[model samples]
Target: MAFVGMDPERIRKVAEQLRQSSHQLTMVNETVQRLINQATQAWEGQDTLDFSDAWTGQHKLTLQQCSEQLEQMSTDAIEQIAQQEKTSGITPGGPGSALKPGDVIPGTTIPMDGLTPDKLNAMSPEDREKTLEAMTPAQRAAYLASLTPEQAAGLLNGMSPEQSAGVLAMMTPAARVAALSAMPTEDRRKALEEMPEAMRDEVYGAMDREVLAQTIGHDVTLAKTESTLSVEAEAVGFKIEAMGQGEMVVNADGSSTVKLHGEFGGGRTFGSDEKGASVTAGLEAEREYQFASPEDAEKFIADLKHAATSVSIDNPNPIDDVWKVLDSGHHVDRFGGYLQAEGHAELGEFGEIAGGGRIDVLATPSEDKLEASLKLHYDASANAGDFAKFSSGGEVEVKGELEHGQLSKIELKASTNGAFGAELEGKSSSGALLTTTHEVVQGSNIGQGGEVKMTLSADNPGFSQVKEALQNGDVGKATELAYKYSDVSYRQTVNTVLADDEHSVKLGAFGVDVAKAGYHFESKAEVSTLIMEKPAGSTHYYDISGGSR
Candidate 1:
């Protein structure tokens, strides 16, 4: 029973042969069943073994020879079956036949190959544009979202400002900011400036202050220098020292002297000494003495004596002859020259100046008259204020009349070739009537087109007579009295009535109204009986009894 093991050489040879022959032997049913059982064990906290102990050695030998042999065998078997069906002319599923090129197989599907080159070439430009426009921003975003960083940049390069802003506005804040950061500086700045305030602030907040300052400072410095002043002045002058409040001390030739204050025309005065001479000027005029020797005082006295009598009287009129020649021709027989041998002229023309060499005719009386006549025709369309002007040569003329100072009837005319004229009529401060009818025509063209006539008449009704007549209830007398005092061609009627223990007077009129409408008047005997009524017809009927008498 304990027989000797086989010889070493024979045993080694037999082991090698058995390992080589392992591929030919199929696994035993029991061993196969064991592996199946182990693999099916629920994979719960245990390692799986595919071969039992009986087949371990042989399985190792076979697996060592080819690890992926089972997978290759399965693929080979499928390929062989396909080839066999094709050669036998039978479909794989139905009769084991393979599909031929361009054949449509029953119960088999094929995907549409990605867009064909021919189909893409056939698409019209309009169709492409419409397709792009029809795409929702979110859809487009998804397409862009899938791109690599490089592809996204290249795609964005073709977009316009409005297009970019719209696309970026739809992006998330973080993504938009990242995209802006990657842009060039100028592009980034333009994009940031165009963005909404909130977005711009967010992006600017993320920038470095130093970089921002440098960028903005360039523009600010450029703007500042563009408007800078570049002109230059050449001279820098000297100043003089004031000896006192008003006098200045002049220094020259190694000596000083006080000069009188001559900066202003009427010379300024400083305090005076007992003799009433200015101390500063007096000291400067006096000769100084140094107690060095008798010779020094003697020399100073000599200099003072020489200065006292050094005044010289030169020609009083160096240009006397030249001026005499000018004076002779000053009275030349011309319209504008000196009126006398002295350089003076009496301006006789309406538009000339008397004293000045240059005469301004525009500001003269004649010019004023011309302007007045033109303004009268043009500006008379509206109720404007009076126009008047003071000529340069002391002339005053009435361009128009003042409404507040209007005379009822009077016209003033200018005297011909005269300095003064007379007013036809005017009102005095005491309400007395003044009239003058002597017409003096200053202008030759007067009354050429038509007679310019004016008249003055009474404006106030005789209040004394109306008051007396109304108190007596004499309506007829009051009517006659009111008509006599009124200016317009109108007849007035007065009526008195008693109502509610109060007396009321009613005044009515026809013809020549104050305005375009006829006149009306009302009065209450007592203040208590008066009532205010609304204004009517752009005119008024006053019940003045309620007001102070």
Candidate 2:
């Protein structure tokens, strides 16, 4: 029984050792299987094998044991396989190891020794250009000689004209001519022309002038054709006027001699001593004059007028007695009755005329009187529509008070507005008859009388239109209409309208039949205010009657 029990214990211990050994074998198998699986996956491009796994004790064996086993496997199995593959006559270092016929080795610099044609042919265009650029003249010449004629020509064509010419000039004459002859005609001519002038002259001298002319003609034709391809350019047009006072003379040397006599509006006038002083190469065309002030200009004009008058009076034979009267100041009263006419005032110096008061007539005599009368009418018709027409005929006596030597309390009466067909008659302060026709239209008769009187305020529309037109853009139209409707009170109303649109308008007054002809008045005004607004956008209305009577 003891022996039996001992045998059972031995069997149990053996069983336990077998179990422990089996457990260790199972762990090793599991690890090996995982490593094999990972390696297989990596070989198939699916998963990576973790070499760190063996060193980190993730496997059954210790790190030292795993490393020793791996090293042994590499030395035995891997090396044996590699040797077997090599022994089969495979090339050393694997595919792409040996250099091909045209392959360049990495990091290899080109040789700078004697450049052979074969070596140059192997270089890239850029490399060749760089090499050529770096070469000395003698070296470049030697290299160029080695190239084929076609290759040399191509290279020369690529070079700048000046550089190519320099290189060509160094060549023998025969060689240069032969090379040029091989090029296109245009290219040949360009190369020949780029040569030194003496060389070019020698070459051209060999050719006939007719041939040279033909070549030039061809070039000219080509230039014209190319020029035609360009678009037409725009031209600017301007009007120029000669504004200086002087005589212009043309000189022999295609220059101009401007002999300035006196300073005119634009340029300095040559003095009397400079009569023969000719200005060679004077201002190109017109001379411009500059005036320091309006007063200076006026004085110049006055001097000119006095000079002209003096010359006329000093003539050996005078034309009329008027000149004689003007020459002698006191003779003026003999031509007309007392110069102190009620409605008339002598302008400037009237001492020459007997019984006359000197009053500077800055304003037009006819216009001033007409405007004054019209203002009275416009004031009386303040309630009328925008469009109203007034006419008058027959004799009308004007009665007015003179305040500060100006007309006031003016009165007018006559058949007007197409009602009475008769000539309009008015009396001057001297009781002279001044006649005007009356034209009638549809409108309320605002007033009619031989002696109408009223006080006119400065705020009145009659004054406002004139003032506004003068101060604004309708200046021109205002001036024109003011003269036209010299007798109308709101004559400058058109100017007011014009001033709103056009900025510049010049005003000028013209005398009518009621006063002496050729009388003029002027003022600065804006163009906009001078236009009148009708039912349409706007219209220019001008009174035909001179703003006189």
Candidate 3:
């Protein structure tokens, strides 16, 4: 139950498997049910946030599934005709030791030989109904389960609609599938054919898709996505950003022909206020393309990066030499070797850090790997984190994989010094939905810190809540939700610098900087993630934002 080292995902899978096999292994299932509860309990009160995080939906599903399975794990109750719990919960018996009709049907004393098929057929429907009504629901279920597949089918098909519904209402879904499985092909078809439309559809819909597909050759194929990539995008009032790769393969006896496709959208806007005008001012799109082979996809991906390098990397600059080093064995692409940026960033949770950073990357396409280092020094102005215009500097080392058109995996090791000293590291996989982001965190937390891991999904409820808040013109509510949502799990160490290094700072109660302190101390969250949309699935884009406090 103390699943400390055990992977939660593995535990979740095992619980699922046990729930499915609970029928034949009842008591063990009960134990597993209890264990699942324990495991769920372990997740409570773990994080410090007012709103739900990424795992919110999954945790709810786990508990709901556990409860449903518990209700269905009936132990040895159906084997005996007079079980206290009832046969409604048990597996249908096999021919080896199945109970006879007389044993299962309450108060029926007729000998098996005397109650011939002919005699049963001769009985009036009213008399048959009366006989069935005499038995308890449990006994009726047992009687049905005890029959051979053929006999069970005969009984069901012979029953009136009202009787069939009555029996189905009492039996569990598992029992129904079992009973249906035992029927003869033609008889099973007839039984289902007569089922109420809704009931029939429900039963069939619950069946395994693989079986259904294989049975009827229901092959469904979506166009292949050749590649996905991340983009460095800019948006004005009217802007859009999208990148994609897809392809169709048409074959003939001779050879397959080639098809080329690509898409791009981006925008830019400068605005002073938020207003409900000019819907076309923003640009966004989902694009698809086709490629002849994976190589074609790779070429497109590589070319995009190459174009980006040419646009951003200027000639005659020291950074160009970094590009030469990057292009030693291969041409640098989007995440190419040289990156020099000069911009002032205002972190929402944390205070303002005004500075630029330089990035140098060594990419080994032969090894499908990339290694990069980045350094940035900043002069921090007064921020919510109590920084009094201190100088800060940091470095980050990244090792990652270039797969398809994206960084499939990345590992970051980083450190910071100056007003605050800190060390951080994390790993990220876009395919896994979320990642651990490493930043130049110089212990400047006006807000809290942790190795915050975020899982991204279009269906993520936390993200959805934030989106809804913003849509409803609730900026404050949206900010709070967004911060709480993806802050998954973070670890913070508040570096205490002796007051000897203290300086004066100011605070405002209502839009006016009225209060001043020497070397101010307050928490400010160095927040990001407002503009960037965390890619929901695998794409070529860098799955990380390189700059954070």
All candidates: TM-score: 0.18, 0.18, 0.24
Local distance difference test scores for all models: 0.29, 0.32, 0.38
lDDT string for model 2 (1-549, tens) is 112212222332343344334435544655776687666664743233455445345654553355444433423432233234345432222222121223222233433343555565466645555666665443443344334545555555645555556655654332354455444545655565466644543334333333332222221110000000111111121111122233222211122222222111111212221121111111122221222333443344455446445544356443454344334321111010111111111223211111112111112232233122211111111111233322332222233333445543333332121111111122232222444322222222222222211222232234455457877888886565334322221112111111111111111123222211111111111111111111001111222112111
Q: Which of the numbered candidates is closest to the native, going by highest lDDT?
A: 3
Q: Against the hidden true structure, what lDDT does model 2 obtain? A: 0.32
Q: Is candidate 2 or candidate 3 better by lDDT?
A: 3
Best by TM-score: 3
Q: Which runs of model 2 end up more than 4 angstroms from their true locations? A: 1-130, 146-148, 202-549
Tens-digit lDDT track of model 3 for 1-549: 233333322433344354445433433444555675666665656452222343345654555566456433321222222232132333222221233333434567543323433454356656555555665543444444444434444455566655655545444344555556554433444455455543444345443433222211111111112223323222234434333332322211111122232334333333311211111111222222334334554555565456445543344344554444334332222223344444455555454555556555555454465545555544553442333344455544444444545534433434343443332222222222232221222232222122222332233345577768878999999766554443122223223332221222333343433322232122222222211112121111221222111
Better structure of 2 and 3 per TM-score = 3
Kindly list the per-residue Cα lDDT of model 1 for residues 1-549, writing each as its tens digit: 111322222322333344333323323433565675676576543233433343556754565445235323433433343334345553312221122233322222321122222332244534323333454442333333333333333333445555555555654343455566555544555555456544554444434443332222221110000011111111111111121111111111112121111110111122211111111111111111222222333344444445444555664443554344323321211111111110222232222222212111111221221111111110011111232211211111223222334422212112111121111222222111332122121111001011111111223324356557989999999766554443121101111111111111212233111111111122111111221111101011222112211
In model 3, state the lDDT of residue 363. Answer: 51
